[model samples]
Target: MLPSGAFVLVVIATVILHCNGAPTNCTITLQQYTTIQIGWTQQQVTQFLGSPGIIVLEVGTAGSPYQMISVQYSALQSSSATASFLFMGGSLYTKSQAGIDAGVYTITSQQYTMIQAGWTRDQVTNLCGSPGSAISESGTGNTASVSVMYTVSGTPYASVSFTFTGGQITSMFEVGLSPPVNDKITLLQYQTVQIGWSQQQVTQFLGGPGIIVLEVGTAGSPYQMISVQYSGQQSSAATASFLFMGGSLYTKSQAGMDTGVYTITSQQYKTIQPGWTRDQVTSLCGSPGSAISESGTGNTASVSVMYTVSGTPYAFASFTFTGGQITSMFEVGLK
Candidate 1:
């Protein structure tokens, strides 16, 4: 896929007009379309479509969408446009639009891996971490500037696009979408802990043990560090400063550098899923402060935490999560 826009092309299961699953009638499944949205990279698409066959990109195409990126795929032996995915920007488009026939959408005519669709926002976030970035349509019905884009680098991969409207995804297309320039696929998972949540709840969500507390500096200037893992093991350390005298909280992680006084209103701070893109964090937490830390691989990353109240940076406190949900948090500051 190109950097112009990001989209997911998934084949869906819908009633194909009058086809009765007959031998002559080509059977199309919606699986391909849905799978693409869950962050299925171009390599995965290649496994299903086999060599794009035809690749196209229109620079400044009129009438349709600006900075349009698209890819056309053939079913090896078939010479017709079986199916395709379209990406307007970071948000995926749908095939449910007019003129698109569910029966002949070539993208699903062949065989490949399977990924289920109809997942909730949280479910998709949990599975694919967060989109590199996301862009929504303008209120005036015009296209918005491309934010998060997808690339395919140099491989038999397709830039998949997924479109959502009225809360639910409406259509999907494989062609007319940009193939990413870098085909590297990055996976992120969020582990959460909430305030008042017990160790059992933490383990149930994060898979247990890996969670540890470490002390920093001397007894008089001591601080605590919280560490947890996602898919594999996390070798990074997250510091949480409990200022008993000032009644303030401090935390740091591998994502970003953030500092603010928090209140330990509650003794327990739950750890939620982590590894969220800036957009995802903003959508949930607004423009809150950031936490900086290093991953197990020593990779530096930022963690964004938003405060429930707005005022001084350290005047308010909020719970932090890796992805979307709240992880571990504490209340600080004297009433």
Candidate 2:
């Protein structure tokens, strides 16, 4: 004796109840939602979530040619919550959920501390899990760099960026919620450079320098040195020089009050005799432009330091240490 609409509602309710049966609590839990991995395919995701409410496709940025696809699904709860998964190159990249106050991805301080200058891309991904977004920059030929960003839910104003050069992590830092400017490279960007990095790698991280001086090697010699200078952000006059030998970073010298010309007085050079401790030499000539330490058999070890110098032509001071003491010192200049 019920009205037609009421009868239909009753039938729908009965069908839902029959479908659910038993305990009848069908809401999706947080644990159920987080099982999705980064490398899953669209078909796999659809199989897991049944069907998505909407699917959007857009072109990828920079290096990738594949279209980026976004699949959105509604949560099974009464709150009408939704989750969106992003896919690139037919594989999952990241996911986000709305109306979820808790974090979808978690990165601890210990994990952050584990990241180092020389870590590989796979190593970083294994330690931090998958990032929220990945950006790629391709330079001349096969050289390229990728930056992966990890953004936490509920806190949209903070993110962590891991930049890779030649498949190795060259820099990692926290950035504001906003995107970075395309042109200017900040000082924080410069801090990412490490020893033995290539010139192309430096450019990929810090952009181009203010001045570039290329020293072509002699005929038939494969070794070449390049000196790049950058004006400081705080002080326009302040400059830092990066020297690369045979296409690799050899040394870095910060701007100082002294003129670019590095000179050693005869008396000062005489004081650099053997048997001098590194501390004593450092006290006399300040710190070297760059230093490298090597371990020998037993307790013996040696250290090499490069100092910038200027004379008839450009030159560099080289000091070798053995047993923590100076063994020899010499100066070499351009021909």
Candidate 3:
């Protein structure tokens, strides 16, 4: 059953089930992920993620004196990605993620309760972990404002975030770290899976995002890779893993994804080479490929993107640009 004003979501992700229409697609990348921040409104997040999120949990009735909501953006294309957000009065209060830093976290639900205002950054780091993933920051010197998040990796996923003014904590937030969940995938559901499906499509078909089990390569890099595991029909011990490359289903031990469907063909990829202008590559490949990671400004700008093609021997192309010209390039999982 659903609370008032809440839409149905996921067959097995949580208690609610059934939906009125096709669920909104939530396909995200590493670069897009960084643009999100705490305090953003639901409309803002939906615009960035490409659709309104399914209202997973809503507390109190529509006009109740108190209200809160928890929403999720599932099975992202970014390496080792997972996003969970909480809102109060329709405004974001807390958010968490994995694979943004490519570093392991050990923060627990128990530790989250200890976080308090006026604590020094060092005290929180000693209790949680040093150098929590920097969510956002502004200003400089002693007046600086910064927010950091610490996550508990692996089972019972959880995390905590803190905001500081000057060098002292001002506010804190956290999410997840609850008990494990049932992914609700069966052999029959698995049969419907196909190569090259977007993460959102897989989630829609399978009924949930499953657990993010493996994160390879660094965050914000072309080499980054993420694998998600779901339960099998046989038993809890028998699980399934899906590897994603560039936000598309790359592998499940069946046929690989059709990267060429979204990116360039082998012939177009070859036409792009070192020293080629960004426009030239776009002309040759039809698109510049999805920008995975980028930095700098104006003439000093540097960007990195991925171009994947179907077929064998020549797939998975990565390109780096500086000053709008190709600076470096590489490939992944050549077969």
For each of the candidates, give the backbone clash count.
97, 0, 3
lDDT of 1 at 127: 40
lDDT (C-alpha) at residue 307 in model 3: 74
Checking candidate 3 for backbone clashes, the offending pairs are 157-177, 196-257, 260-310
Residue 12, candidate 1: C-alpha displacement in angstroms: 32
Model 3 residue 218 lDDT?
36
Per residue, candidate 3 scores C-alpha lDDT tens digits across 103-134 of: 55567655654555567788888987676876
- Model 2 error, position 13 (Å): 22
Worst 10 residues of 3 by lDDT: 253-262
Q: Write the per-residue lDDT of candidate 1 for residues 154-173, one digit (tens) a residue.
A: 42354334333333223222
Off by over 4 Å in 3: 1-24, 63-65, 78-80, 103-131, 134-335
Global lDDT of model 2 = 0.56
lDDT of 3: 0.62
- Rank by TM-score, descending? 3, 2, 1
Q: After superposition, how far is residue 124 of candidate 2 from its true place, in Å?
A: 7.6
- Candidate 2 local lDDT, residue 60: 72
Candidate 3 local Cα displacement, residue 249, angstroms: 56
